[model samples]
Structure formats: C-alpha cells, structure tokens
Target chain A: MASIDIEAEIRAEPPARAPVQRVTLLAALSWFAAAAILLLWQDLTFQPLVRELALIWGAVGVALVALGLAGSRLGRVGRWTALRAPWLLAIGIGMAVWTVLTAKTGLLPQPFFPTPQALLEVFIYDWPKILHSASFSVWLLAKGFFFGALAGFAIGVGMGWSRAVSYWATPLLRYIGPLPATAWLPLAFFIFPTSGSASVFLIAFSTAFPVAVLTWSGIASVNRDYYEIARTLGASPLFLITRVAIPAALPHVFVGLFMGLSTSFAVLVVAEMLGVEAGLGWYLQWAQGWAAYANMYAALFVMAAMCSGLITLLFRIRDRVLVWQKGVVRW
Target chain B: MVASALKTVPQAAGTEINIQTVSHHFDLEGAPLPVLDDITFDIEPGSFVALLGPSGCGKSTLLRLIAGLDHPAQGQIQVAGEKVADPDPSRILVFQDPTLFPWRNVRANVALGLEAQGTLKSEGHRVDEAIRLVGLTGFDKAYPHQLSGGMAQRVALARALVNRPNVLLLDEPLGKLDSLTRMTMQTELVRLWQQSGLTAVLVTHDVEEALYLAQRVIVFGPRPARIVADLQVDLPYPRHRGDPRLAELRHQALGHLGLDSSW
Candidate 1:
C-alpha cells in the first residue's frame, strides 16, 4: 500500500548554471541609485523623517560598497562588473564627503545629536571604553554558557538515564526551573558582590536550569524500541546510552544549548545593569546618567550586532554538525 | 466431522524429540489464567509441522515455548535429548513482525546474531551463503525502513537461517504481506525448506496455507487451547492450488474448524 519511488524524486536535477551578469547588474544599479539620492538629498532640511531616511540610506550605500568589494574578491561578478568594488567605494566616499561639506556650508541644519564630525569624535574618543566593556561582557557570557550548559547537560543525561534519579530530582528541578534569574538578583546581591563573579553566577543560574529541564525531557523521549534492540544484542547500559540514546537526543540538546546561550547573554546584561562596573549594560547606564544619548545608542547598536552575529555563528555550527537532518524534516 | 484419532503410522526415526505435558498460564496478580492447557506433542527431526489454530488459541504461545522464549508453568520440553531452558542460537524464532534493527542494513541485520555471538569472522562464509540462499543476493546495504514487509521478512528468515539453527519457529511470518507476496514467500519458504532441510514449525490460522505449506497441520481449539486434529497433506512438493486432493483435505480441515457452519 505504501508504494513510493524515492529514487525518482532524489535523482532529478535542475538545469545548468546561468551567468552572474544579472545579479551584478542589479548591484551596480542599486549602488548608483543610492549615490544619486545622497548627492541630491545632502542639502535638505533635517526633519526627523527625512533625516532618518538619509542616515539609513547613507549606511546602505556604505554596506553596498563593502558587499561589492567582497563579492568581487570572491569572483562573484561578471567580467564587466569585476572592477565594481572601486566604483562602489568611490560613490560611497563621495556621497559621505559631500554630505559633510553640505552641512559645513550651512545648506543643511545641524543634526539633533551631533554633526558627522562630532559623531566620529565620539567613536574615536570612546573606542577604548566601548571595546573594554564589550570584551568584558562577552567574556562573562561565554564563561557562563560554557560552565552552565556543560553541567546542565551532564545532570540532564544522568537523571534521564536512570529512573531513580528522575524520580528524586524531577520535582525539585521543576520547581526551580521556572523561577527567573532576575528574581534571584536580591539573593545574589546578599550572597556575592556586584562584581564579575556575581554576573557570571546570575547568567549561569538563569540559563542552566531551563537547559537541564529541556535536555532531561529530550533524553526521556528517545525511542524505547532502539534501546530494546540494543539490549537484545547484548549492549551494556552505558553502550546503549552512548550509541543509541545520545545521537537521537543530540538535536534537542543543541536546541537547549542555543536557548541557554541567548538567556545567558540577556541575564548578563541585566545583572551588569544592577551594579557591575564593566559591561555593555554598565556603559549604557553610565552614558544615560551623563545625558550622552549618542554613546548609549552606539552601545545599543554594538549589543544588537553581537547578538545577531553570535546567533548566526551558532546556526552555522548546527548546520555543519547536523547535516544529516538537512533534507529530512523531522522537527 | 470429528474423525477419530487415526492409528498413527510409524515415523522414520531420526532424533525422536518429545514435548511432555507442557502447560503454560499467565499469573496476573494472584489469578492463574491458563493459555495452553496440557499441550502434548512430538515433532520429529527434519519434519515440517504447522501448529494451525485460530487467533488467541495459543499457537504462538506453543511456538514460543518450543523456541525457549518462555517456560511452561508445568511439564518438560526436550529437543535432541536435551532439556530447554532459555533461547539459544540452536533454536531461532521468527516473529509475525520483522524485528530487524532499523539502523542496520539487510546484511548487517542478518549478520547480527553471529556478531552478537562473536562468530562473525569465523562464520562469514556461511552468512553470505545464507543471504544467497534466501534470494536476497544484492540487498546487502538496504536498511529495514527501505525494505517492504515481504522483503524484510525474508531478511528475518536469512538472519534465522544464517545461525544454522536446528529448529526454526515461525510465528505467522508472512501474515503482514499481501496475497501475491504471501504466495511467493510461501513458495520461496518451501524451496528454502527443501534446500536447507531444517525442521520448521510454522504457526498459522489459514487452513489452506497450513495444508499447502506443512506436511502435517496440527489443529488447535480456543479457550484453554489444545490440539483437536492433526491432518496430513501427502501431496508432493510444489503443490498446485486446485489440486483435488488438496481441495478435499482443505474442506476436511475447514469442517474440523467448524467454518462449514458459517457457510
């Protein structure tokens, strides 16, 4: 009744490759259009809507230039647009320089926060502070994730592997897993200082509990029939866990680990905001107290970039490791 | 339609095994639920026997008893002058479902029993030969999921045969296949039986199939099951469906089962 020709579907292939001319052409047209808009709009008034649009387009031009350069380096374009990187970079620099010149000539009103020169000055002057804060925060996050996820995964596997352990620990862990890390802030303050160690502990406490619970449930749900076959084949309990159970639970474990990573980052930021002296959260609070809104905005941008980049990195690792699930849609 | 028990013909002697007064019961809580009540039968070596019975009639329980998967609450079962205690490689049981490991391919599944017993290297030649014997010549790397029910059952047969078990216990191995596949599998099974000459005890409810495959069909009754009739099919190998002798024997077996009342 279940007649399926899997081979036929699998063996079919699409047609041969097309030229890169179309994509390169589109990129070139977009770059030129962005350049023209910037040159035309540099002298406009600084209305909130128009100013935001200009700033956003200005960033887009810069990004396009970088993308074009990188694509050319990777030999991604046609023969005509092979040298498009220099053209794009020239357009970007020309627009930015023209915008600065127009502002100097009093053609455009002053920016709300800073002139282009002032924004550069802030970036140059505060580079060291921003770098230090980001590095310190990232370090704490990594430390929390490494220790917490490892310990949680171990505990989960152990508890799930044994019925007695599950019976004893499940109740306690269930009660603790849902309690937010912020709820423990007061307790942590009394227990440890607002230093690096407390931040890490807060991050770990928030991340590890949920990760353990997920992992235990994941391992518990592994197919019992696989284990029976293993047992019938004379596999020891340890062998069964290592060979059959773990591989089957790996995708879920990775999901838990990723969730743990994000939670740790979030908890680190909040914990730093409490009283920590050196982190992105601390930097934001420090900037706001002094009414330096630009510095706060910049720190916020850096945090967003870091979180996005780290998530992409995690997904890349997952893709490479779990390549077997690529074509199959199990989840 | 109950024919009196026939004056038993003397069987050619070769390993005259005995299953003495075997009775099995399920002890659920404190109550005794009898499955097979005082089952006494003898299967001579190198003979094809069918334990024919309706569903829930303890045919499989009897087969399991012979396969050493379960113990009788009372009495003794002896094979080749030795008492049965536990499942051994010498006696293999093929279930109604193909219990092949999904992770392993056909050849690996077949070779598992040998590998588990740590005889793979020493018995590699025989494993290959058994795979060839079951007509699964090229399907070495085909996993169980990729196999059809009939093919998977064949792989199970190969697995059982590769171990060179003296007694083969089949618990409705072809029950899951379609009519065409079942017929082909039955033909293939008979061919293999003739070629290998292993003593096989197949449990089935289909009276016609029981007659077609087995040299002797042991009929059983339900509710504390026991043997009710033992019919012999004297027709030779490769028996036809419309063989008049088979038709008469089929009707006799059906009548004994009281299916004539339904018609």
Candidate 2:
C-alpha cells in the first residue's frame, strides 16, 4: 500500500464519533418502536385497557408535538410537512372522522363499550352532571387537606419543640397512628349527628397526629451544635426555639405534612364509604349500589387524578420552602 | 516584698480586687483529681499577660477561672475590683474553638455579646467598631458555614471585644490554626490588644508565641500545675520573631522546657 500522507489524511478526516449521540439515538429509536408496536396492537388487547393505555401514549405524543411546534413556525405548514405535529393532528382527526362515519352507516358490525350516540349523550347531555360530581369531590378533598395540614403542623411543632412531650407521647402515638381511622366509625357516628362531620373529623384527626409526631422527631434529631452555638451567641431560649429551631426543623415538618395529607385523603374515602352522602367516595358508593360500574370506575379515575395533582402541588410547596436544604439528602 | 507590693498595688490602682492562692480540680463521678495547685497571681490595671504551658498544663483552667466560667475550689478569682462566682459578659472568655453560632451569620455573632449583657443601646458603637477592627468588613451577611475557620474565629474575637470587658481571656485562640494562619492571627491579636488597651490574659503552649505577644509569659509545670517560670519578654510592640534577642530568649526559654536540644 502507498504510504499515507499523515498530515493531509488527519486534516481531511471527520471528527471521532461521540458516544452521547449514539446512545441518544438508540434511546429515541427504542422509545418510538415501543410506542408504534403498542399503538398498532391496540385492537387485539383487552378493549378498555387498550383504550386507556392508548390515550396515555397518544397524549404523550401529542404533548411532544405541541411543545416542539409551539414557538416555531411549524403551525403554518399544510399538515404534511410538520413531522411530529402533523402526524398527531392527522391521527386525532382520522379517529374522530372514522367514529362519526362508522356510526352514520353501520359498517363495522359491533362496537366496544359505548356506541356513538351513547358516547355523545355522555359527552353532551350528561357532561354538566359529571362536572358537578367532580367539583363536589374536589371541594371535599380541599377541605380535608386544609384542616389536616394545619392540625398536623401544629401538633408536629409542639411535639418536636419539647423533649418531654416527644418522650412521653411517642409510644402512645405509635400505637394510635397505625390504627386506621375507619376503626373510629361507631364512636364517630354516636357523637356526631351526621356522617359528614364525622368523616371530616376522622380524616383530620388521623392526618394531624402522624404529621405532628414526625415533625417533632425531625426537630429533635437536629444537631446539638446548632443549639449550643445559638446559646453561645447569646440567643434567649425563646428566640432560639422560634427563629433557629423551627426553621432548621422545617424540612422534616413539611415531609410530615405531605405524609399526613395523603393519609387523610385515604381515610376520607374510607369514611365516606362508611358514612357520608357527599364527596367522591360517597358518589362511588352510590354508583356501586345502583350497579353503574362505569360511573364507579369514572369516580375512581377522578379521585386518582385529583389526588395526584394535589400531591404534586404539596411537593412543589415543599421544594420552594426547603430550597436551601437542597443537596442535603434526607432519610 | 514582691507579694506585699502586689497586694498593695491593687489598692493604689483604686481597684479593690485580689486573686488569692487559687487551686482547681476536676471531679469526675465523685472522684476528685487536682489539675492546678496554689496558683497565686495578681493582675494590675491595664496589663497584658500570657499564661504559657504545654497541653494539659492547666493554662486554660486559669483563664476560665478569670472569666468566671469555672469556679476555683480552694482560692479566689477577682475581676475589676470584685469576686466572680458565675459566668458573666463583664470578663469575656474566648475559648480555643471559635464557637460561633452556626445559625447566625457574622454580624449577629458579633452583636451577641452586647445583646447578652443588655448593653446594646449604650454600646452600639462597640459592635460596629469591633467588627471593623477585626478586619472582617463586608462579611456581615456571611453565615458560619460560609466562613473559613480563621474568619469565624475573628467573628468570635469581635463578639468578645464588643462587650468592652475589663479583662480579655484567650484560651489558646490560635492553637487550632495551622502555622501560617497562626502567625497571621498572632499579628492581628496584638493589633487588637494595642488598640483596645484592655487587660488580656492569653493561654498558649508555644514559647515563641507567648514571648512575642505578651509582656509576661507564665510557664507552668506538669500535672497539678504551678508556675515554673515567669519570663518577661520586655520587647517593644510589633516584635520581630527574627530579632536576635527574641531568638536568643526563645532558645533559652525552649531550653527551660526541654524543647531546644541544640541548646
């Protein structure tokens, strides 16, 4: 072989391939293949499960396209040129058109779940009722969260701030905290005239106790040096407790609040199942008694979505308040 | 005569204070072990002195006694014409550790001494002036975590200075620092002492450090420690460690402590 012109060859050669691009390409291709396979096999799977899962993937694909095309001039394209967005929009339009056409002409023999007119009735005439039900459930959850978080924070602060309380009350709390709030049904029904008040009280009580205990434990676990330095710096006992101790123990307190909130929600639903005539749990119970399985399932979907949203909001608040404690891993 | 003169001189200075033969012991679980014995010392007005000894030689105990942080069992500790039995801001003690509050930043730490004494209103200048004197300007907002060890200790020094005490007790303040940082701190300490003109009692183990910084360095022996030597530096302010006289004195003092084998 002819001797290579080293300098010229080196100068003419392309840059060495980066592993990052290769890995990213592999990941993107794998994800696209999985989505395509899932979407194509939608008809062969359990119809309800397939529909729910397809909706989730379709939402994801739509979201990607929407976000990608939002700031760009891609929207001006006549549907074909814009790869991500066009594909998503075409799929949605095609599905809507097919559903309408298939109903107008009885072409595909038998349909799954709801016929076109039934789905239309649920979407149009029954929409107002569904909205009312969802809103009522959300309102109940909001009330439970507010009362639960407040009581929990106070109890936590009290227990955490004082050693005597934490020492004496912990054993009692450990026993009480684990016992489900539903166990108090007989007593609650006896004391309160209506199940509504009893439900609210039971949920709040269950949430507050654990929140308070966890907050107190967190405060107690803070480093002794923090307190000693405060003393040496001439901070009065009161000032030390309020300014230094509380702020330092805030992270743990919030965690306790979040935990309490989730627990309260769970207890609220259980309480509704036993007692109340309102709220999402009450609605689910009513639907189940009427043998309306779809309504019961729909109510469940609403509960899941609402709880996820509320929990996300709580975490956001936790992150904002405890930003300084970022990089410090918590147990 | 010197003892009699030391006694009478306090009266002449118009301060009716006396530190009679003092001794202290540590009692651990009802077992008493003596640490210092018959430690008789009288401080005159506006005097800068250093208590020099090796580690575990009870130099810190002597400072703590002066600050009223510790009580002497067999003797008396008098400060500014009065006896001391409890901790007070009047006779401030700066321990070896910076001990700055981790929560409070530099400004708050400096203001602490005045706040504790309830003299904040009358002595607002003290806090600002002390912070400025310590060369920690523009670091008011920095927390202890943000500060280097030297800076944190400087804030501690400022806190003590803000109290405007009759006596300043330093218990090996520079002992924790590395050699370079320690040398820098020693210079800063001298500047502070000269400007403040308050009576200071430094407890240090370094012979040269004590000699260079203090007018008098009181050396102590091992366990149940007592003053073994009271060597006077007699050198002028802003002393040079490289000076032949300082080197010779340091060498001789080192000999007394079995430190300079060449001697």
Candidate 3:
C-alpha cells in the first residue's frame, strides 16, 4: 500500500519544463508587417531604390526565420533567442516604420534624414574607400592604446607602490589629467614630424591619464591583508607586486582600460579632423565639406558600429580573464 | 585518525621561541596607543601553548610580532636562536580570517609559500600532500569563495603546513566556525600538531578550546596586555568536552579573565 502511494505521489508531481520549440508568433507577425510596409508603399519614384529596399527586408525576414529554426535545434541558441527575440522584433519593426516615414511618405525631411536604401547605396558604392580609412583609423588606435596603456600601467604601479613616486607624480597628474586632449594639439603638432604621429600622440595622451589615475587607485585600494599573507609566505618585493598586488588590482585596471578606449575614440576623431587625410574622421569632414549628408551619416553609422564592437570584444576578454569574479561582480 | 594525513611529510624538529621584554605600540593619528607591555615568555620546542585573553588585549599583536610581521618597540623575539627581523615561511601565522587569495585556487594557495621561495618546481608535490592533509584533496581546484568557513580555514591550515613551518602561530584560526565545526577542528588541530611535531601558539578567548587542545595556557589581562596566569594541563589526547578536568580548567581560565564562573 505504501509503495502504491509513493508511486502515485511521484506521478502527480509536475514534469520538468521543456524549452520552447515552436516559432514565436509575434516575431512572424512583425516580419509580415515589415514586408507589407515595404511592398505597399508606392511613394518612391526610383524603381531600383524600391526593389533594393524590398530585397533587404525579404532577406532579413528569411534570415530571422532560419535562425529561429536553428535555435530550436540548439539549446544555447534557443535560450539566446528566448531572451532576445522580442527586443529584436521591436527594433526591426521600429526601423521599418522609420524608413517608410522618412523615405516613402516624406513625413520627415529629406537629405538630413537620408533613406535607409540611400545609406545602403552609399555603403555599397564607397566600400573600398571606407574600408581603407577604417583600417588606418584602427591602426592608429591600436598603436596609441598599446603605448598609452603600457606607460600608464607602469607609472601607476610605481605611484601606488612607492611614496616618493606618488609624491612626484600625483602633482603632475593633477595638473595634466583634466585638460582636454585637443589642448595639446598645438604642442603635439610642433613635437611630431608627421600629422599621423601628432594624432597618435593626442590619442595616447588622453588615454594615458585616466589609465594611470585608475591604476594608481586600484593598487592603493588592494586589501592590506593580502600583502600580509604574502609577506609571511617569504614573498619578495617583486612577488608581492606582481602576484599579490597586480591581480588584486586587475578589476580596477579593466575599468581604466574601458575609460581609455572611449577617450581614445573621441581624441582619434578630433585629431583626424585636424589635418589627417585617411581615416573615418577625415571621411566625415570631407563629406561635410561637399555637403554630402548621406555619406556623412554613413561614416557616422560605421564609426558607431566599430566603437561598440570593440567595446564588446573588450568585455568578452574581461569575462574570460576574471571568471572567478562571476557571481560577485555583475558587469 | 587525522594524524595519518600528517605522516605523508616527514616532521622536522620544532623551533623554540623566546620573547623578552616585548612591548609594542601603534601610532594613532600621531598619538601612541600601547598594545603589549613588557610581555615576556618562552615557548619550548614542540610544545602546544594557547594564549587565552579578553578581546582587544593585544593577543593578535603578540602573534604578529612572533611571526616577524612586525617588531616590538622595546624588546626582541628570537626564533630558534635567530633574532626576528622580517617575515619567514618557517614561522607561519594563520589568521582568524583564512585570508586565502581569492584569485587563487586551493592548490595555488598552498603553493604560495613554495612559489615565493622559488622552490615550487621541486616542492610542488607538497601542495598536493598538504591538500590531502587538510582532507581537501577533491577541492584543490576550488576557489576560496566556494568553500564554507570551516573548509576555508582548513585550506589556510594547509597553506601554512605546506611551508613545513617549525612554529605555527594561530590567531584564533577557528574562532569564526560554528560550535560543532570548532570542536571538530580543535581535535584535528591537536592531531596535526602531534603528528607534525611543530610548536604552536594559539590566541583564542574560548576557555574550553584552550583547555582541550593546549598543554599550557597563558592568560592575559585587559588592554596593554600582560601575562596574568599560566596554567598547565596534563590531559590525555582526544579529550572529551564533558570531562570534569577540562571543565575545571575552563573555570580557572574564565576566573583569570575576571569573569564569574558560576555557570
């Protein structure tokens, strides 16, 4: 009798929840709405422009459906889509509505708000030039960020670890840290032979200050107990700094890296506008000079994408390196 | 039973500690705050001694001084006939908090001393042995945060033991554990001390704990700590908490602390 009761109780319990497998209805509806808007809207005078817009929308819808099917087969993909599909649908539909309003109905102004199709045209036509400029800008950013982060890390460690270093550097950092990178443009131009080196110097200087300050603070704030433990274990001064202090200060160093990256981008753009002829910032300036608003917008979009992509890459590296801090630190 | 774990490493002769006229003070915003005053004691090699005292009585400060993490303002501490000046792995101090580097795993924490001494390549096996000694063999890869309070304290013990320290100074190492774990660890500590044959000086306020573990108990007076009582316990190993002799020592220790022992 007891065995039967146990069996009945186990049977009565709820089953484990299976992952959602069916295609999301709302996502399908959103795609249909976008398609209808693309096809029914007849205000565009250019047939090729309308065809291009239709083709892009159709491709996106098909890709989303194919991804949803693949997601159902893969558990991780299914989980990702379950979390992100609604937001993706909202963005897709919102953009489709925006395109119809600005390009087809003429509800918003032309030239200032170029059609998405026109922007696509600019992207396709100016691919090589844009790619070349982007690569140059990236090269400049990599060099500046590398040297800047290295110098900052070394100086910051010295300042934090030694009283004499702190005494000397703190005053200098205070005087220079708050000044804009552009303030040194005149000095940088005078010091460097090429405008390229000048631009690199501007970016490097802007990046270095924040990295130095944050690294100093990070090293300073490491718990005194860690040092005590390491010292008792026969650790040398080098071991204490490298093994105990630096690892303890890494989270702070990452924060500095993030700050340095954003500042580098800002300085890079302004430095390019100064005199440099082959970068995204230069492309924007050239477009503005010719009053090619579409090309300027195109360059702006690429810059936004590139910056965000780099930030995401940095975050991925931080997550991998700082895996022990998984639950303790949310970001 | 726990002593079996200690047999993996051959025990070295314990070191003797001689602290003479040791006085220490900290500078608090330019004003001196005395912590220990003319504290003098001798710990024979391989003896288990417990320093029992009230809170804030400079017991931990005394431990730190013996560990050579700090120096006295007035006197000197000699370990194995050598004048103490700086921290050495031979006289390891286990803190109240485990203080394991959160970034490192259990094996790495145990390996720290060897790594610092640049002998990790030759002595790396000691880390694994230490982990096994603390009964944390399976948890060698676990981070400090993943362990319970008792488990973390065990890892800290392993970290100290891996150095094969002659003198183990414990600053209330098990004070943070629950009553049950504390009682268990007290026996474990006694077993390890016996097996390893290392001199240990424990600073704790728990009277029963001191009586159950240490052969000699040194009681301290309030602030500006001074030795008030030094009682010897001639008890057998694997002692029972309910033993009448241990209860008497507990009362005596409490009495020295100026606490009524009526309960």
Candidate 4:
C-alpha cells in the first residue's frame, strides 16, 4: 500500500505556470495599420519625419509579431512589452491621427501649428544650440539647488532642535515664506552685481522656503520615543540629533527635497525668461521673437522631460533608502 | 561560536536598586495630574522582579523614573549606591515596542549602545555574541520590519544585552507576542538572567507572567499607582508552569488586585 501511495504522488502533475504573452494581437494590427497609412499616402506638404515615423511603427509591429511567435525565449523585455500592449496600440493610433490632421491635410494653421516634421526639424538642425541652452539651465539649477538645500536643511534642523532658534526663525518664516520668488525680480537684479547672480539668488530663494518648511515639520513631528531610546542608551545631544532625530525624520526630509525640486524648476524658468543670457526659458523667448513656434514647442518638450526624469530619479532613491519602512510606516 | 565577547564586563553581579518615596505627575492643561503616588521599593542584586499593575496605573512611568529618562516630582532613585541623575548605558531600558531603529539592520541595532558610547571600535564582537546568544546568528542582516513580532523582540533583547548592562529595565518586553511565544520567552528570560547575573526589573500586567518569571512580584493598584502587596516567590530556577505553588501565588496576586479568589 505504501509503495502504491509513493507511485501515485510521483505521478501527479505540477501546478501550471502562467503562459508568457508577448503583445496583444490588436496592438500589432494597430501599429501595422499606422505604418501602412503613413507609407501609402502622400502628405499635402513634404514632412521629413513622416518616413522616420512610418519606419518606427513598422519596426514595432514586426517586433511584436516576432515576439508572439518566439514566446518566452526573448526574455524580460518581451514580458515588459506584453504588459504595455494597450499603451503601445493607443500611441500608434494617436500618432497616425496626428499625422493625418497636421501633414496630410492642412487642418491646422502653418505658422502657429506646424507639422510633426517641423517640430522634429528643430532637434535635427539646431541640436547644438538647444544643448548649450539646456546645459546653462542645468548649471544654474544645480548651483541654486545645492546651496538652497544645504542652508534650508541647516536652518530647519536648528529650528527643530532648539527652542531659541525656533523663537527667532518662526516669525521670519511666517512673514517671508509665502512671497513668490519672482516678486523679488526687480530688487534682486538691482542689488546683485550680475544677471546671473540675481537669477541664482531667485532660484535659491524659491527652493529654500518649501524645503525649510517641510523639513522643520518633519523633524519637529519625529516620534519622541526615538529620542528617549537613544538617550537611554547613553547618546549625547550631538549623537541624539545626528543618529536618532535625523534618521527618524528622513522620509519627511525627502518630501521636502521633492517639493524644493519642483519650486526650483519654476524659479529657474522664470529667472531665465527675465534676464539670464542662455537657458531653455530664454530659448523659448528667442524663438517666439522670430515667430518660430516649432522651436518653442521643442524646448517645452525638453523642459517637461527634464523635470519628470528628475522626479522619477528622486523616487527611486527614496525607495532604496527607505526599504525597511515598507511595512512599519506609511506616508 | 564566539566565547563571550562581553567577558570584559567589570561588574559581573547585578546592581542594587532602591526607590525612596518616588512620586511623579504630569501638567494636564494648567492642572497638576498625579500619576505615581509615593512608590517605594528595594530590589536585591542579581534577582528578577516584576512591577505588576493595571494599564493606567503609571507602572511604566515608575520604570522611566528608575531609568532616569524622566525625573520624579518628589523622591530619589539610587542604583548601586549612586543617585540616577541621567540615563546610563549600564542600566539599559528595553521598551514594550521592540523600538529597533528601522533604518538599521540587526547587527547595527545591537551595536547602537556601544556606537553611541564610542566603544564599538574595541567591543564590536559583543554584537555578534549577543546575536548568537539570542539564537539569531544567521539573521544579522535582516531589518526590524522583515522580522516577526517575537523575532523583533529577540532583537531588542540582543540590543540591550550587547551593552552588558548591570540592570536591565524591561517595560513589558514580551507583552505584544503570541501566547506560545510569550511562554517560551519566559523560559528564555529566566535562562538569560541566570547566565548574565544582571538585575532585571520587568513591568507587566499578566499575573501568570509576574509569578512564572519574577522572584518578587510587586503588585500595584489602579491610577495614581500605589503598591498593594509585595509577594516573594521562594522558588528555584527552571520552574514548572503546572506547579501548584504558582497557582496559589496567582490567587494571592489576583486578590491583591481586587479580583475574587474564586476566579
């Protein structure tokens, strides 16, 4: 009977794993339709990007068809691609629709609203100029952010840790924190030696307020038990502040940094628009002056991507540092 | 296995604690609210004791006073003949919540007391020894959130034990664990106390917990906590839970806490 039971257990089949899917059939069909439309029809006006866009859509459709046929051998990328099938299909259809409306037919005006190729033309021809402006913007933002974050962190820690510091800083923060950084444009320009210096001060000013406010709250609201625990373990005042208070309040400090980044971005653009020599905002103004709206649109895309990429990076760093908090605490 | 890295402990026996007319109160909205009402007690060296009381009776507050985390409004607490003016690493307090720094892993958490005192450079091996003693040798890299409640509590014990404290102040250390874990830990606690020779003061509300582990059970009444009875258990180490004497002592303790003996 025991030998029979062993044989029966051995004969039982294992639980089936989920099947590996590539792309949805509809997604492959959507991209193929888009590619066919672009390759077959002649646009009313010649758009250089039309051929490039058609090739991209065609390649995606081919890859999806190949992946579906190959199954799991393609690995992780294939799995990821399968998850984004609906999004890929929607984007393909939207792109085809945009090409029809703008290039194939003169539905939108020319000077104000250009074809897809016109926007791509700025990157193709004027990349060097665009790169220079973006670099200048990055430099100014980096300098301002570094200084602002440092000063704000110090002041916030000071205020949170000491009652005397809180007493003096509270009134000033209440009075000045809410004023927009751009409001000081005229005065800052007059007071500072150069337009560059003035813009740097303005960006720093905007970044400082949010960072300081949120950091102060974070430190102040730290659980009292953390301090007590450290103190009971013979922690000095310095050790308590550095080890217990700061680490305990780190999640909130990250929140402050996030808010500071966005505010600094706004101030950077405004400061650049007002008087700075070269930046994305200056490029936008320069393009508008020549009525080159396509350049403006291209610069806007760069700005949105830059800001979004930084936000995503910050979140990734936070997840790594605060991994232990996944179960213990939630914001 | 490491051969007791804590062999450098200068004071092998536990320190004596004497609380003299200690009272404390909190200021609640411009009114004085009394919490501990003239509590007095003396604990012998290298003995296990429990301050058993109801939740709102301020037993934990008295523990805080003894640890010097807070000052008593009226009286003084002396440990080893010196008045406790501030918290010292030698008299470590382990809270009910494991309270392990969530940012730190087990090894780092156990090294905290030594790190804070700038002695971790020479005494770092004590961290591993404590971990091994707590039966968590392979979990040195696990964070507090990754551990179960009992495991986390064991980590807390290791963190305190690494300091080689003369007096261990336990504020309901096993209160949050499941019943099975609690019983097992009671045995573990007795074994640890016998091995280290450290004076242990545990504050708990469970009657059986007070009787099973502690040599002396100081029972307290409701809010504005006052000692109702101080019953001594003259039992040897490795006690049996089914022993009839524990049941009889349990009845006495329950009677002191205003519960009927029949129950």
Best by DockQ: 3
Best model number under TM-score? 3
Per-residue lDDT tens digits of candidate 3, residues B91-122? 99999999998888888999999999999999
lDDT of each: 0.72, 0.67, 0.85, 0.84
The runs of at least 3 residues in candidate 3 whose Cα sits more than 4 Å from the true structure, single-residue gaps closed, are A1-36, A44-48, A65-71, B1-8, B261-263
Report the poorest 10 consecutive residues by lDDT, candidate 3 chain A.
Answer: A6-15
Over A1-331, each residue of candidate 2 has an lDDT whose tens digit, in order, gives 1113223222332323211222222223333443454446323223233344445545555454444433223333312222233344445444444443443333453342333333433434445665676676667666766787687776666677767866776787788877887788779978988777777778777777767777777778777645544444455777667766777788778877778778877887887777776767877788768765556556676778888888899889878776545444452
Q: Estimated TM-score per prediction?
A: 0.68, 0.68, 0.93, 0.91
DockQ of 1: 0.15
Model 1 steric clash pairs? none
Better of 3 and 4 by DockQ: 3
How far is B110's C-alpha from truth in model 4 (Å)? 1.2
How would you order the candidates by DockQ, starting with the best? 3, 4, 2, 1
lDDT of 1: 0.72
lDDT of 4 by residue, A1-331 (tens): 5335323322332214433343345567788887887778787877777778678788988877776554444456555555566677687788678767777777877768777768877898998999889889989988888788787788888888999999999899889988998999889999999999998888888878878887789889888887888888889999988988888878888888899889999989988998897999999999999999889999998988888987898899899988878877775
DockQ of each: 0.15, 0.22, 0.75, 0.65
Question: How would you encode candidate 2's per-residue C-alpha lDDT over B1-263 as one tens digit per residue?
Answer: 12232212111121223568899999979998888899887766656788877789777887767766568989897777578876565567787888775556688778876665466788687777778878899998777777777887899899877766667778888888888888999988877776666677889888889888988877888768887778888787778989898888788777767677876
Better of 2 and 4 by TM-score: 4
DockQ (C-alpha) of model 4?
A: 0.65
